[model samples]
Target chain A: MGLDNVTVKPHEKLATALAPELTAVNTLIRERMASKHAPRIPEVTAHLVEAGGKRLRPMLTLAAAKACGYDGPYHIHLAATVEFIHTATLLHDDVVDESAKRRGRPTANLLWDNKSSVLVGDYLFARSFQLMTECNSMQVMHILSGASATIAEGEVLQLTAAQDLATDEAIYLQVVRGKTAALFSAATKVGGVIAGADPKIVQALHDYGDALGVSFQIVDDLLDYEGTGETGKNVGDDFRERKLTLPVIKAVAKADDAERAFWVKTIEKGKQDDGDLEHAIALLKKHDALTETRVEALDWAEKAKAALTSLPDTDIRQMLSEIADYVVARLR
Target chain B: MGLDNVTVKPHEKLATALAPELTAVNTLIRERMASKHAPRIPEVTAHLVEAGGKRLRPMLTLAAAKACGYDGPYHIHLAATVEFIHTATLLHDDVVDESAKRRGRPTANLLWDNKSSVLVGDYLFARSFQLMTECNSMQVMHILSGASATIAEGEVLQLTAAQDLATDEAIYLQVVRGKTAALFSAATKVGGVIAGADPKIVQALHDYGDALGVSFQIVDDLLDYEGTGETGKNVGDDFRERKLTLPVIKAVAKADDAERAFWVKTIEKGKQDDGDLEHAIALLKKHDALTETRVEALDWAEKAKAALTSLPDTDIRQMLSEIADYVVARLR
Candidate 1:
């Protein structure tokens, strides 16, 4: 009945292992988020930064750095940089998605306005670039900046791809990578780069983060159809929003004549009515879309773990391997 | 009249002097604004980039570099970076301002949507950072990134300061610097740094840009109140929008009890009746606020010209000096 009997999540375990560096990252984030002239910047940033998410992306940076046997203050800066980028994207994403709730609270956009969200988000992105520059590594600057471009490009792609019925698996992958994986991979890759790890090891870390991000996103999308209210998202939220995620894309790919018209009405034209969620789920299940998506998620999770085999057999590596498993374990 | 009899604008002179480099910058801008996966990126960006604005900020970068005898190719990169950052900010600014028109054309926010504007602006920012990194100068990176943060901070400050009666000359200056002068100064300062100019010369270049930017913005604010038709902005647009530009701030500062109530009702409370613009202008003239604002703008322009005395007296420098004069010349 004690803590020993409970199953601690891999992220929690990783957080525990890297608590000291994580604290430094948080401290740096607080310091950097403050604006001497603009109190609104800090106020809006604090709403998102102090929101109690897992800080998983920054932890990936810390974990990657520690796994590569690096000891440096700059890793904390890089970790904070990753978190800032993630938080900034979250702020903008809420505006772009017109989301009202994030992490179970009113979004910054809702609390303030879209203007605050946009400007404060720009502040954070600029702050993130400032953080990365303090690392003084050209390679790091290139990777992080390149990742920023990819992230923005991906977001623009998602905006265009959102309701289109013709969006395929390749576009879905690109959008997912843009919205989620670009930062994830950049987060992990910059950690290794700052550590001066071997190029192969750096690539491996990147691959790990990329696969883990794709798997994590796919699982989250799948949960939109399959979950019973555990993931902070209601079932069929994506369907209600007329989003074309992987499962829906697969379902659409296999749709017959009658099914195509139904999807075109609901997804393409966004003309949903009562029981559309149920019918969408029925079609997804009928085409085995959810099952196939889950299988793909599992494969990506495996690939994440496989990528980690290139690293040294340290405790951090073991924790990372387990985190990959934990990512897909949500589907169970 | 013969071409020689015409009063060629100083910016046109600078453009004629730096045509090849401007061409290179234009070429580079077109190349980098492209996104491999998202055609929307180019479509949205081209709408703004090709919209035939003056391209003043990037020209400052090119002018500064060429004035310093920087024969290298990277100034084109730096100039393009400045333009990209400027364009990015404009896109986001239109969204924040909810502007329908920019440069006498429909803004990207209106042409596409706020979502496209926000995301495409971000892409350009990222692309700007990437372009700066290609210069391989850490000093350039630091200066540019720091300016980016300042620009964002200034914008957030402006947001919180808008419509507030307490916003004074100091806050107005800070906001002006943030919204306009930060990037201008950065564009010029980085050109000097990249040219390996002496620290004194670099400092002077920064001051020149800073003062020029401050003056340029004050004139713009003044134009909103005074322009008949030449400036593209309708007179009293700022007052209509309830924007606390320099004139309003100065006028508010000198307000008597009745005038104070007028400002409180119109600017702060956003309750305006017919003839408010006429009354507002009367208050500005009665209190000499517009005159004072124009004087300060002239003073800043003088300071901008004075700062350039430290640089090598090249033809580009002479054009830059005239450019400073031309910035305020519109007031006459």
Candidate 2:
């Protein structure tokens, strides 16, 4: 199936199977967003939450829990917890990146102020903790809390690594895990744990989520370089921010001295303009970094699919495998 | 002995009692701060953690737990959790206030960058959540999470209240509870809960900590107007920032048309200069707002002492009562 079809099929089945749970999570999100003391919090949070981005993180949690035969009510709470954390990170990320847009909408920092974004993000984080506490499971709490710490560490790593061409693959993995995959892995892992799944099943869910998250982020990074008119984000978004993603890191590793000087001047020294993007793309192409990045993304997708072997041969598991395929199929 | 005698005694006894636990917490803090991918994480965190502010929040947890007659290891972990949260909030607060000095040293934002401060603050918050999870106590997690939410809400409330002289007692109370008292209350309450204290004693500790925190913040506000000589903070600091503290609110409430116009011109409109500080102080004196504020602080201190009545008349309880007195006694 195509990527859109794959997403649509699973979402339809999952929504019908977990409609009540999904409703609870939505209610929790609204209730938690309300602030009697700081009206600016809801104002900024609603700007982002209500702006129509897909509830992917929460969906991941719900799907994982359901796939593991979860029959309890706490999954809804965990789903909301995951979404709150993702939203909180997004608010801070926009401020750190100085990005004007997110999900084709004006970011919270852009609509309000960085101050509002930062504080509201913090409010959401606290709210997530509160929600997780309601689950009354220390194992669930540990999983989510550890995920939050990893996400923050990853973001910090990304911030410090930006514009430094010497950043290695290990650092790149840590940054991507923090910036994207940490939440995904945590969301799915917590879902399984809350369901009281067997340790083996929980581990399988975790590995699946981690590989899927890595694949998703790699595709996003690749799209920033090689995606055409179909992808909403423009090419060279990372280049504009002087972000040292996998492609740039790979390209730099393969560059000659003269090309290295050009990158240093344009990216590190912030001397880039419109033509610099074209030159950077040309350099990436010459180094085959784009092709290598695509291969790595596919490799992660296959790894994600392989993890599903440990899961039961349910429709959900099949759909998850297809989802991995869909992520890599985006490159086509 | 009276509360005064307890004030003279250093916290060495409490620290000694809690040493082994505190060491574990310190180890956790250190381990959480480590980021192999980001060398700057430790560098930035060390600048704040090593700056040597009193570990008052953590100590509250330790003291409360010990006072409740519990011998458990989790209290130290919870103590560190509170400290981490407090430290994270301070880093963010400095960035929000654009503050240069904290605890007689340059703020992290000044030494590093606001970006680093912001990210590191986030890192600390995540680490705090992780630390709280280590306690494996849902009650402790709930208390800390609720406090964290309240704290964030209070900050945003303060941000909106800044320069608005019409901010009243009710709003000010919410802000003070969120920004200061919430953490204090949580820190102490978690101690009692972890010690398996009864609900009544837990409530007592919570009330005592809340009252003490309110008194402490109010005294800090009062000192901004009346303090001199090695307190180190500038006098009229609130006036310069146009902060609507208790004194400012009371003074504005009692203002005549002429004084109100002056306030509108100076504080609300941000037209204040060095001379405006003198005029504002003169207005405060004319309305006796300074005296009123001092009286309010004393009232809170009395309330704090009264809250301890439920506790057994032990030395630690007595010392806690005295600590409350010492907080407000600075005004006398």
| DockQ of all predictions against the true structure, Cα-based | 0.87, 0.73
- List model 2 lDDT by residue over B127-192, tens digit each: 898888887787888889999999999999998998887799989988999999999999989999
Model 2, first chain, TM-score of 0.94
Score chain A of each prediction against the true chain A by TM-score and list the results: 0.96, 0.94
Q: What is the lDDT, from 0 to 100, of the residue B184 in candidate 1? A: 91
Each model's lDDT comes to 0.90, 0.84
Docking class of 2: medium
- Docking quality class, candidate 1: high
DockQ score of the complex predicted as candidate 2: 0.73
Error of 2 at A302 (Å): 1.6
lDDT of 1 by residue, A92-143 (tens): 9889988888877899999999999999999999999999999999999999
Candidate 1 global TM-score: 0.97
Clashing pairs in 1: none
Model 1, residue A96: distance off in Å is: 0.5
Q: Which candidate comes out best when scored by lDDT?
A: 1
